[model samples]
Target: MILVTGATGQLGTAVIQHLLRKVPASQIAAFVRDDSKAANLLKQGVAIHVGHYDDTDSLDRAMKGIETVLLIAGTDEENRVHQHQNVVDAARKAGIHRIAYTSRALKDPTTLVNRLMEGHVHTEQYIKASGLSYTLFQNILYMEAIPQFVGGEAVFERGIHLAAGQGRVALALRSEMGEAIANALASPSEGNLTYQLTGRESYSFYDVAASLTKLSGKIVTYTPAEPATFIAQLMGRGLPQLLAQRITGFVTDIANGQEDIISPDLEELLGRKPTPLNEGLTLLYKL
Candidate 1:
């Protein structure tokens, strides 16, 4: 059986759905923190194993009879690494033969300026040293999150204003990444393997501006600003200081070319081209 942690979240849910198409529901198990939130998975006949990253006993219980574990990266930035370690230890103790982890796409994990990237790098190292058969999915920035990076409704109201400067991002949809994860789990292999899942092409904010203009038939433009200025703008809009800093860091990472990755692994897995930027944006924004 395959156990998926964080199964109630968006990426995890998508992965489970794709896995169901390839395997029977009885063969899939969801490791969720709350059973109440997993009503849909229960209705779909998936086994719900309640667990949390902080609770090793719960993780142990969740891993029972599971041969493969899909360790979805956690979101709590401050304690993410420790939480991921908890899962890793539990998976090792459970004697899981195969493990797949979701990590960010970075050319060099050690040199990245972003805190989120740093956490993922630490987790990846821990998993690699655990000696379990593993697949490292170095996922690129999701096109669906373009709205968050580019500013959801605010972009339409103002413009494509960001601190990203002239940086480009090779963004692919989360759904495609989910499908790839499911495919990886289907074929278990020995030794540690890494796949850089990215989009076919990279795009700058100017490209995003152009797409928005074409889709909305309006004269929208991208205005790059200093990181401090962008953070000030976000704060002025009533966003929390910590949140503003975190958001601006993504733009900083992009400007440093950390997110400008273009690879064929995603397309190879799907046996089709990964969704294009304009198409992803149109579908995401309904424009």
Candidate 2:
């Protein structure tokens, strides 16, 4: 049986939805921290097992009779590695053979400025050392979250403002990545494999501006900012200090061309080209 952790989140929900299309609900289980949040999964007839990354006993219970576990990376950047290790240890005790983790698609996961990337690097290493067969889906930036990054309704009024100078980022829809993950879970593998699930094409902030302009027909331009200025502006708008810093770091990473690589593995798995940036933006903005 396949068990998916973080089953209540958006990506997890999408993955489970796709999994249901390919397999019976009886063959899939959801490992959630709050069974209350997984009412939909329960209604869909999925086996719901309550668990948390930090709770070994709960994880052990969740892993009962589960052959494969999709270990969704935790959001707590500071304590996530330790939490993932806890799950790994419990999985070993439960005799689970295979694990699939969702990690970022970076050329060097260690060199990034993002604390989240560091956690992923450590977790990946820990999983590799655990002796269980693994699949790592190094996911790229999700196109669906463009509104959150660029500003949702405000972009129409203020255009796109960021510190991402001219670097390119390959984008994929969150649902598509979920589908790819489900596909990986459905197929068993003998050796550890890592797939960089990125968009077929890459785009820069300039490209984003142009797409918005074309879609809105109202001259949406991109204003580049220094990281310090960007952080200050975000803080001025009432964002938390750590959050402001993290958002700025993402722009800086993109400016340095750290996330520009394109990969075909995602499209190869889906048997279709992933959604393009412009098309996705048009749909998002209702242009």
Q: In terms of lDDT, which candidate is strongest? A: 1
- The estimated TM-scores of all candidates read 0.97, 0.97
lDDT of 2: 0.88
Any idea how many clashes model 2 has?
A: 0
Candidate 2 Cα errors over 4 Å, as ranges? none
Can you give the lDDT of residue 80 in candidate 1? Answer: 89
lDDT of 1 by residue, 52-116 (tens): 99999999998889899999999888998999999999999999988889999986565665677
Predicted candidate 1, C-alpha RMSD: 1.2
TM-score of 1: 0.97
- Point out where model 1 deviates above 4 Å: none
What is candidate 1's local distance difference test score?
Answer: 0.89
| Model 2 RMSD in angstroms | 1.1
Report lDDT (Cα) of residue 220, candidate 2: 76
